[model samples]
Target: MPAVVETYQKIKDLRDKDKHEKQKDYQSAVETFEEQAGALYEKLREKEQAVEQFNDTLSHGSVQAHAFVQHRQYIEHLDSALDDLQPSVQQARLKMEHARHVLTDAYVEVKKYEKLIDMKEEEHMQWMKHEEHRHMDELSMNQYMKFFNR
Candidate 1:
């Protein structure tokens, strides 16, 4: 029938849509990672330039007791920033991995649930078959009684 065909087509279309959406999400995550990496690299270059500037300044000046203190402090700040950046970038990558893990877990769960449903349905069908046979036996007995009375 046309209705049956239409329903099948709709189911297929919905599955296709879901597949496309998942692909889009994967592409978007990759783009985000690339953009973050590029920005981090640019910031690293800028930070390096700051260190170079500080070193050049120190070279030009006569060494003073306080000058080393300031130089050390500047380098410390740079090191701390880099340290912080590492954890942040790592966290993002970890999030991506976690998302993948969650999807895998869901897939595994779906298979288990599907198997459970099939088992339940099979049991239900057996029960229905037994009930139908019982009813048919009762019907046959009632018909025999009616024929004898006639």
Candidate 2:
């Protein structure tokens, strides 16, 4: 029983380590997703600022045909860039979700191992108590026989 308990303790330790590693992986995934989202937001902001600047310039005077064409092209380009970024952002979010699920599984596994260890320890304690009671009974019997024979 002791050996079995020791083996279970080792397994519990390994599970704990695995849980920590999974937690780290989930945290890294979260950070990566945040960074990607931040970058995409910054890019969109820059594009908006550029559009605002172009509109300001246009308002200051009569717009030339070439400037109108340039503005249309920039808008088209911004639209395409946003379209491209949307998929990447979605992919990052999915990865973060997957990492979260994996972390949850790892945590459950660690808890299961911990529960097993607790049960085994409880069993071991009960066995020890039973053995101690048996020893006391034997000592009492020996003393009784000694007194009777004397």
Clashing pairs in 1: none
lDDT of 1 by residue, 1-150 (tens): 244445545555555555555556655666766666666776688778977887788789866878778777877876777776777677667766665565555555545555555566667678788999999999999999999999
Error of 2 at 28 (Å): 3.8
- Write down the TM-score of every candidate: 0.47, 0.83
lDDT of 2 by residue, 1-150 (tens): 588888988988898898899899899989988988987897799789988988898789888899889888988888788888888888989999999999899889888888988898999999999999999999999999999999
Question: After superposition, which runs of candidate 2 have C-alpha atoms over 4 Å from their true positions?
Answer: 58-61
Q: List the residue pairs that clash in candidate 2.
A: none
Cα-based lDDT for every prediction: 0.68, 0.89
- Which candidate number has the best lDDT? 2
RMSD of 1: 8.8
Q: Which ten residues in a row have the lowest lDDT in candidate 2?
A: 78-87
